[model samples]
Target chain A: MDDQQKWRLELQNSNVEIRATAAENLCLAGSDSVAAAVDLVVACGDVEDVQNWAAAALEDIGAPPVDSVDALESLVSSSDPLVSYWAVTLLGRLGVDASRSQVILGKAVSDSPHPSVQERAAWALGKIGATEASVVESLKKAAASDSPRLANLASRALA
Target chain B: MFWLIVALLTGGGVSGLLNPDWPIVGPLVTSVKTQAIEYKNQNPLGLVGGDAGHESANTAGAYAGPPVQSASALGPNDKILMATFNIQVFGESKLRKPEAMAVIVEVIRKFDVIAIQEVRAKADDILPRLIAELNADGSRYDFIIGPRLGRSVSKEQYAFVYDTNRIELDSASVGTIGDPADLLHRAPFIARFRPRTTDPDRAFTFWLVNTHTDPDDVPEEVNALAQVFQVMQTARPDEDDVILLGDLNANEQQLGDIRKIPGVQWVVGGGVMTNTRQNKAYDNIIFCAPATQEFTGKWNVLNFEQEFNLSREEALRVSDHFPVWAEFDVWESSGAVH
Candidate 1:
């Protein structure tokens, strides 16, 4: 197997140290080996550190294939909420497309009851220029959510 | 021996059959008898063990969500079809071609008139190139790119596109009339079109405006829409059909604020993609007088993704949202256009 393949297998290794190290290295090479790395990390499933590292790598790749909407959408159904957040955050950062942003952001807002997840979705929607009225209302609601900090974030999003 | 068999049947065999404790008796009985309680008790979540990917799934009477989409209200009405999708600032880093274009194409396969929003500037950009590519690929469509002006730090707006012969756009402008600067979107696209139909009066004028409002200034988006009427009152002449299309961030419920200006009839927009989780109407095609009553049309959302069960990955690849298409037939009243 290739060196990258070896690293990916290492991610599933029982040792946390080995897995974390391997994930970081794969991220470093994402621009070169994105397809393999993306597949492996996503398949890694619930490993929080590994999934996040993979998201970071994909975000770094940044254009063309990175501009790929299917890749982001795949992460929407991710078992880990953090991984899903990372996907939405990265998609927002990449500016995937204004049209698709609404749908994906809509998913993030609806599916994720976690307040933090909702907060991230609200920000992404604003960045995406969400023309939808509900997004507008949700942003307004989120801006006023129970948490003081998130409320502040929500208010800013209203702007 | 017959007495021995009768004794076995009465005392031993009958008791074993009635209670059925195969585990204790077992080895011999399992081979002979089938419906064993012991077997049923063994794999209870298929709680019958071994093979994985089970559990939680055993919760049969659990909450199954609502039914998926019923069926598309827009199931093949006419031979010719047309659709418009403004992918919001094409040729930008954020735009995912796979997701956005897939959804847009899925919705707009047949429609003849497609008015786009936030097209690439005439300056050095790939958006114009992309438009050219679309034109080259399709036979039915020959795109007419119109007056360009910058909408924000990034986008220089685009408001028009069409098939060459079938719908001849006599003139296309950013604003309804006069200097383009008067209208927001640098001038909402005002196109004069002649629909080729059998009847003479059917040769009426139609106006299409594809626009994306200022996300920062909600008021600007609102005011820009209000100005659309001013264009109709003057530039479009006394009697003409006007159909304003685009991502009007304002909801249909709030559309009254926009319609208050005059001449605009606010015809069919209840069925547009609101982009919200809740089914609130957002995108629009507010119409002028004659176009308003143009046969009292259907206000469709054009969201085919719900009916066509594409996996989430595949659907997002089309676009974040489905294209919105509205259909209307022409009708005149009191010798004047409705």
Candidate 2:
């Protein structure tokens, strides 16, 4: 098997360390295959370390397959802050190409319990540069957030 | 039969003793070996500055501390400046840019000894190359690097680069604190140093624990670093001054349990932003104020954008984090006001 195939297999391994290592290797390898992206998204649910590497791998993959957007959008609602944070990070990296995630990204900005995830979602909205009324409304509400950092990022996104 | 199986399991059976390569455990053995190889690859200390006579002071074993010597009168106004900088992702890309390297080198030249973090590279020549650039003007500088560390494949190494003419390294006293519990993402690199002074007896000798805590795991890592500080305090029986400095990823108020350490004080206090963004305060230089009486009450974050007259874009290219520094008397203060 090629290296990507081997790493894809390792991503599904029961061992968290093995999965983490595989995600890391996949990132370093710079493989942007949809198959690898799917495997990494699945690995995101494993552990914090695994989620970090997997998120990094997705970001490194940059311009992931449009088909992968659904998986990423679904992950934004995850209860795990880190999981949703990484998911929003990758979506933001997708730029205007991830337009379909605008609604979910907006909801995450206003409704996500975690401030970090909300911050990233706001940043992602800015990257998306959406002018839709709903996105602007969510960012406006976030602009007055009690968290200064979050409010600042939301204001910037609106800008 | 039971005895034979137990012996085999314990590696005392005839076949196990003779071959030592039992097939049953081969997969587990291979995994262990792979992990070891990965660690060695990430470390790359053996490959650092190869054949260039670029020495990294990482000698093994515990330090016996400085020998007792006669006290001598310290010269007036003798002092040194020390700093900690997280030059975000210092690697080949950053090195190739002469403008950025010059800005970075200029920031480093401002201090006598600077602890650097985020030295991310598969190759080991980055630090040596940086030293070469710093000394292009005939300044004598050297560096000591710790093993690269991280939970991800994107590992980072910590380095203490010092101007040899202004500072002297205790060559035998360099190591990374052992973190067997996997608490810190990157264990702090530690070393001891004293000013290059005529009065060796009175030179202010101190240990520096350089670290960069994971931003995602700040609370736990900062808490664990408290233990690291406690360990370094006692690591050298003869040493009383231990200065822990690095990109802590948290401000003074958020330092967690480390702030609970008695007499612990930090240089880059609250309301100071260390990042180029001028937003978050994520770095500091901490020490026991009572023990390290050498501090001269002077410290500040070096804003390269303002100092170098670079635009915000230009500054960000140089580093996401700016250098934070503190000045100290060259001789042991011993509670002396001067």
Candidate 3:
């Protein structure tokens, strides 16, 4: 099998070490490695340890995986906090072009059960820099939230 | 580990260990190796220009006695140095890097008081270790750390480390802001301090509100800070001199509502960058003007890279943020105090 197929197989392996190793190796592949990016998005949905390594790999990639935006968008709602955290952060890292995900990010900011998830969603919205009225209203609502973490993030985004 | 030892031996001895260009030895090992190197370099004789360099010597003919009238001519005892530093995450990540601690200690020793931020809840050992290190030279240094605070589950503590000989802490006045409005992520901690001085005319007390605002929440937090400031003032009705210092995370222009607070002066200004990366002015020392005229106009952003002769990355490994400081005379003055 090719390097991509080898990594993909490792990602699917039952052993956590094998999956983590594959994710880390894929991260080392850097931003141009679309294959690594694709596999990392798949791994982002895996168990927490595997998911963390995969998300870190995606972060190391430092650019949005053009092919993985849809997958990331879906992962933003994952029950796992780590998965949602990485997904929102990744979306933010994608910048203004990822504006299409603003609605979901705004909802995550307002209603996500986890404080970290809400914080990241607010950060992602700020990163997207959407000036739309709905986006502003959502941030305003979040800015007034009782949680200082969420409020601070929403205030920053609005600023 | 072997390569790190070799690098330390060949590159300027102990100081070279903090060189950012040193080959990556993985994050965990790097912290361990850096600490081991610093431990090896520790000297009892006191290395050249350690604490001694900070001393101010009077000119041969100048008056050396107390009650030095001019603020410019004030000696170290007649002046108090204060600093604000975001030591990144001062926990296990920094614990193993003794070289960084050495730099941190050296920077802090130059000041009478320092407000430190980003102290992790899990790493309570770091402060005791730091205090022990600072007191090793027979200097009496103590710290008051606030409870673990943050809006999120992940939390950090704020602390004030001061030289006992130069300042006295009002134990009763120590408390964190109770944010009923829920405006700030981490409510600032207020500590009242009275400068130790024999000259009763010069004795003055001030409240220090140590804070580390979230970068994302600068506008709102900065605005809300005015409320925190007002509450602190109300708590200590007699003290009008209140100084806000820490990683404000906002520049002067971005101060939002904080800028509107009348008579407030941001001492560190002109777009000076305080981060090791040289991109942001994330730290500040702001005080209520006219009330705090003891300010000596001397301010600095301690650049660890330039001071330690280390590479930028090495400095960052110590801390991404640099310490910003301002000097103040122990004596209160009326017009044009330095």
Name the candidate that leads on TM-score.
3
Chain A TM-scores, one per candidate? 0.65, 0.84, 0.82
Give lDDT tens digits, candidate 2, residues A91-129.
887788898788899999989988778877987887788
Candidate that beats the other on TM-score, 1 or 3, i.e. the better one: 3
Q: Individual DockQ of the candidates?
A: 0.02, 0.04, 0.13
lDDT string, candidate 1, B1-338, tens digits:
22122222332333121111122121111211212222223222231112232111111111011122221222332211234565533433223355555445444444556777645422433333344434444422333344444321122444444433233333212222222222243445444444334342434445565555533234545665665554453432334555667666566666544767555665335454444222445566666654345534554555545756766434433333445666554224345442
Ranking by TM-score: 3, 2, 1
TM-score of 3: 0.66
Off by over 4 Å in 3: A1-75, A78-86, A89-96, A106-111, A119-159, B1-75, B199-202, B334-338
lDDT of 2: 0.71
Per-residue lDDT for B1-338 in model 3, tens only?
22223334433323111222233232111111122232223222332113431222121111111221223212376788888998865765456678878898877787788999988635445576777788788665666677777654446778888876576554434556666545676888767665666653346667798999865457778887876665544443356777899988787778776677778888777878988878788799987777788888888999989999988656866776899988887766654321
Candidate 3 chain B — worst ten consecutive residues by lDDT sum? B57-66
lDDT of each: 0.46, 0.71, 0.67
Q: Which numbered prediction scores highest in DockQ against the true structure? A: 3
- Candidate ranking (lDDT, best to worst): 2, 3, 1
TM-score (chain B only), all candidates: 0.60, 0.78, 0.75
